[model samples]
Target: MRQTIESRQAELNAARLRMLNKKQEAGDRRQEAGDRRREAGGRGRWTEIA
Candidate 1:
């Protein structure tokens, strides 16, 4: 019975780690998208001025 409980706990921990990794990846993608928007906006302003 105790072994079963330990195994279940280990599975839950592994699932939690996977979820955290996914969240980190999503955040990195969001940062990259923001960087791209900022770069595009800068170019747009330069074109408007010219």
Candidate 2:
């Protein structure tokens, strides 16, 4: 019984780790897009202001 519980806990931990990794990847992608917009002289920001 204890072994079953430990295995289930391990699986949950792995799932949580995967979710964190996916979130990190999404954040990195967003950061890269922001960097590109900045490199383009803030054209996107200007449009938002207008």
Among all candidates shown, the one with the greatest TM-score: 2
Which lDDT tens digits does candidate 2 get at residues 1-50? 99999999999999999999999999999777777777778865432231
TM-score for all predictions? Answer: 0.73, 0.84
lDDT (0-100) at residue 50 of candidate 2?
19
Q: How many angstroms is residue 49 displaced in model 1 relative to the true structure, after the best TM-score fit?
A: 23
- Any runs in candidate 2 off by more than 4 Å, and if so which? 44-50
Deviation in Å, model 1, residue 15 alpha carbon: 0.5
Runs in model 1 deviating more than 4 A are 42-50
What would the per-residue lDDT of candidate 1 be over residues 1-50, giving only the tens digit for each residue?
Answer: 99999999999999999999999999999777767767787565443331
- In candidate 1, what residue range of length 10 has the lowest lDDT sum? 41-50
List lDDT for all candidates, in order: 0.82, 0.82
